[model samples]
Structure formats: structure tokens, C-alpha cells
Target: MFAVLELGGPNLYDYYVNQEIYSSENKYEIVANIARAAAIALNELHQRAVIHLDIKAENFVIALQENQIDLKVDPFSFKLIDFNTSVLGTDHVKANTASITKIIKAPEIRKKSKNYVNQKVDVWAFGIMIYGLLYSKLNEFNELNVNVMSDKSRYSRLDSELNYYRSNPSNTNLDIIINVFTIKKF
Candidate 1:
């Protein structure tokens, strides 16, 4: 039996690129709501023993309401899609590295090790996605001179960045990202 899925509205990447349509004040909140919804969806899928090998902005669709989108009314309007690369089970699964987005690929995936990947990789990609939404740039972390191969180096760089943001206190949205990282203990 074939199942029909709701196409929903534009994907998160499109919304990100065309964010000018939204007021600057609302953009960050919208992005934050999207991130939260996506995280919940991913967590649900993971709890069901599903591993989405490809998790990125393009895989999340924003559901529009009455030809408009109001995240305040429905924070869960965002839907995670494009599960063609997903697998069943919590064990490490082999994925096609070429199919995954480069910016969000974890260190192991980038290294192309023979060892398979588990849910932790998804968590890493989610973190990268949140970083992109907050900063509007995927290379901000890389620009800090972090050695992508070493997790310790990357975390150290992230710690310094978090410290800078904390000291400045100018960007409130950054606190969200920092809180996420702290909660994840990364």
C-alpha cells in the first residue's frame, strides 16, 4: 500500500534564504520554533528506533496555515521530511557520505571511517543546524580555527565562542544555542 504524505510548505532552507519576507524581530523566533519542532520530531523518530542518516535544513518542511504561517499558534508546524536515507534500529548504520550535507556531517562521517554511525551523529547534525539558524552562517565555527578531525578541538573552540557571547550579552539568541550545547553536555 502506498501512503500519501502532506507536501507541507517550503523547506527550512528556502525559508532561511528568503527570510527577508519575515520581520527581523520574528525571524529568530521562527527559526527557534522550527529548531524545537524539528528536535522533537527527531527525538520521536529516534525513540521509535529510526535513524535519519540525512538530517539538514532541507529535510524540514514548514507547514502553512490558511495560506499563512504562525508559529506562535502552532509551534509544531514544522515537519521533518526526506527520510529516504533513514534506517531502522538504534545500532550504528552505514550511510552514503556523499548524500549527506557537508556542513552538518559529523567528524566520523567526514573522516569516512569504516565504523558505522549511531544517533550521536544525528545529535551533532542537529547542533550544526541550530548553529546555522542562530548565526546565519555555517562556517562561523570553522572560522574559529577549529580542527574538524578532533572533537576536543571543536568543543574547545565552541567553548571560547560561547564565552565570548556570554561576556558580550548583546545577542540573546546565542544563549539558546549555548543552552542547547550545555544541556547536551557538548
Candidate 2:
């Protein structure tokens, strides 16, 4: 027997960007909640020894019921999609560049490191997603330029790249920024 899955709502990219649902005041809360959900989802996958190589705003869908009013207060859930790139276990060798999105790919992927890329790649990509939700500028931050830097320069670029997010007006809530970055994967 086979089961079918249905996704009724827009992808997170459309929900956040096209819909313009986040305001300066509530943006932090909404993005944090969404990030928290994504983290939990990633943790669940990691626990099962699965690595979702494609973790991006576009790959997540927000589910809603029919005629759902007050979407802000509605109990919606995030559903991750596009598992074509997912691996059964972290022990797999050779990253599938064909399936990986350039922007959210981790540092190891960018560096093309032969070392086993563990679950931390998901965490790193999720971190980038958090930043994207905050500033609505994933394109700018996810550009491949940083991927070409030397070890020391690449790490340096990481600092400046994040600093660029800090200086944006969309991140007025410093506490939210701090909290997102402070979250440790235990």
C-alpha cells in the first residue's frame, strides 16, 4: 500500500516574501517560531540518521485548513518537501552537487571537503534560513562568492556576512538576533 501526502499552503518563501506577512514588530517572533519548528524537524531527521541536504525556505510549506481565518493566530504547521536530495545516513560519501542548492549548502560542501559532512550542515543551512527570514535577503547572503574564499578568508567572510545582516533595518530586534544565533544543538 502507498500513501499520498498533500500540501495545501504556499511555500515558506512565498509566505514570507511574496505575502509580506512579517512586520518589523512581529517579524522576530514569527521567524523565530518558524526556525524553531525547522530545528525540531531537522533534529528528528538527524535522530533517524537522515540528512536533508536541501533545507531552504522554498522547500518548506505552511499547512492551513480551509477557510482558516486569523492566520496569525491559526495553528499551522511547517511541512518540509523536496526530499530528492535526502540521504539515508551521514555515512554516505560524495556530496551530490546536482541536488544541492548553491546558496544553503554548508561550508564543507562549499569547500568540497571529502570528510564526512554530518548533520551540522543542516544546522548551518538552517542558520542561513533564519537570517534570510529576518532580512528577506537570502539572495544577497547566499551568493557563491563567499564559497570561493581561502580558509582564513572564508571564515573572515562569514563574520562580515553576518555583520551585514546585523546592520539591516529588518533586524531591529537585537534580542531575536542574539537568541537565534545563541541556540545550540544539544
Candidate 3:
């Protein structure tokens, strides 16, 4: 039944889990990108007052790659996968979870499901995902330019300093959106 597939590498989590070979660059950006996208989607859903109960790596798949990686850790592509645990309409779905993703689970579940859970729950997950991509440089948040926060300390400038806002959250290219083409964009 699960045929008609175009096979690719296993889910990234599986590689990291089983010690299989994978990219060396901190994939924190990848996770952040996924979370960012999810955040945007979740924003729309929340505007309508819906909540997604399940959010995890298994439910995410790398989407595509646009640049040539000089480093082993170069960014690849990914997308959020699996929507099976989703909860929408009604507060009774809280009983269904038994610690699948406590780290990412919305606090509202414990706060009482009647209304504590909202779109911000997904925002929390998005933050975690971005953190995953930024494990080493969480402090870069203080910087004005995310690209200037570049690690090509070894090589390559993070695009042109042309679009200054992308690097600075105050200017917030949040509307700019992250994608496979992000690193490659001039």
C-alpha cells in the first residue's frame, strides 16, 4: 500500500539515531526552517483557532538542496511530515498523549485543554526547532544580521550583506521565509 514512492535517505532522525553517515553542518538551520514554515502554517491554523497535537522529527522530511556545500554540514532540504496525532475542535484530545514528545508538547495540555492550548503552542515548537539548528550559536540572537552571524568562518560569506534585515531580527526578515534557496540567495 505504501508504494509509488521515490526513495531517498532515511528520515534524518534515523540517521542520527543509528549513527549512519549524514551532513556535518549543524542542521539547526534546517530544523529552524521547518519550524519557521510550520509556524507560518500554524499561524494560519491558529487564526482559525486550531491546534496541532503532534510535532516531531519523524513527521518531517528534508525537502531539497540548492547550494553546493564546501563543508560537510551544508544545508539540505526538508519538510514536516506526519499529521496523525493532530487535535482539532474540542478539548478531549489531551488524554491521547503519553509522552511522545514531552520536549515539544504544548504546556496547555497540562494546563487544562479546554482553552489553554492555542497557536502559540506551535510557536513554542517552532522555537525549539530553531534552537536545534542553532545549538552552538544561540547567542547570535543578539546580533543584528543572521547572515553576518555566518559560520563560514571557514569559507564563503552568507550571501551579500545586501539584504541587511534578514540577519537582524529587529528588522525581521521573518516575512522573507527560509527555504532550500535561502543559503544560495544573493
Best by TM-score: 2
Model 3: per-residue Cα lDDT over 1-186, one tens digit each: 566844444454453444322244534444444455545555565565555655544445544344532323334444445556555753333445443344455545533334334455666665544543333222232232233432333112212321343356432224333442255646
Cα RMSD for candidates in order: 6.6, 5.4, 12.7
Candidate 1 colliding pairs, count = 0
Per-structure clash totals for the candidates: 0, 0, 14
Model 2, runs deviating above 4 Å: 1-4, 22-24, 65-76, 90-94, 113-115, 139-159, 163-174, 177-186
TM-score-sorted candidate list, best first: 2, 1, 3
Candidate 3: stretches off by over 4 Å: 1-50, 64-77, 89-95, 111-116, 136-186
TM-score of each: 0.67, 0.70, 0.43
Better of 1 and 3 by lDDT: 1
Model 1 lDDT, residue 108, Cα: 70
Can you write out model 2's per-residue Cα lDDT over 62-145, one digit (the tens) per residue?
Answer: 767767643553444777788887777765444564447666667667655343567778888887788777766655555543
Q: What TM-score, to 2 decimals, does candidate 2 have?
A: 0.70
Task: Write model 1 residue lDDT over 35-140, tens digit each, in one string.
Answer: 7778887898899988787777778887677656543335555667888767677877766665565456676776563447788878888877776676665445
Better of 2 and 3 by lDDT: 2
Order of candidate numbers by lDDT, starting with the best: 2, 1, 3
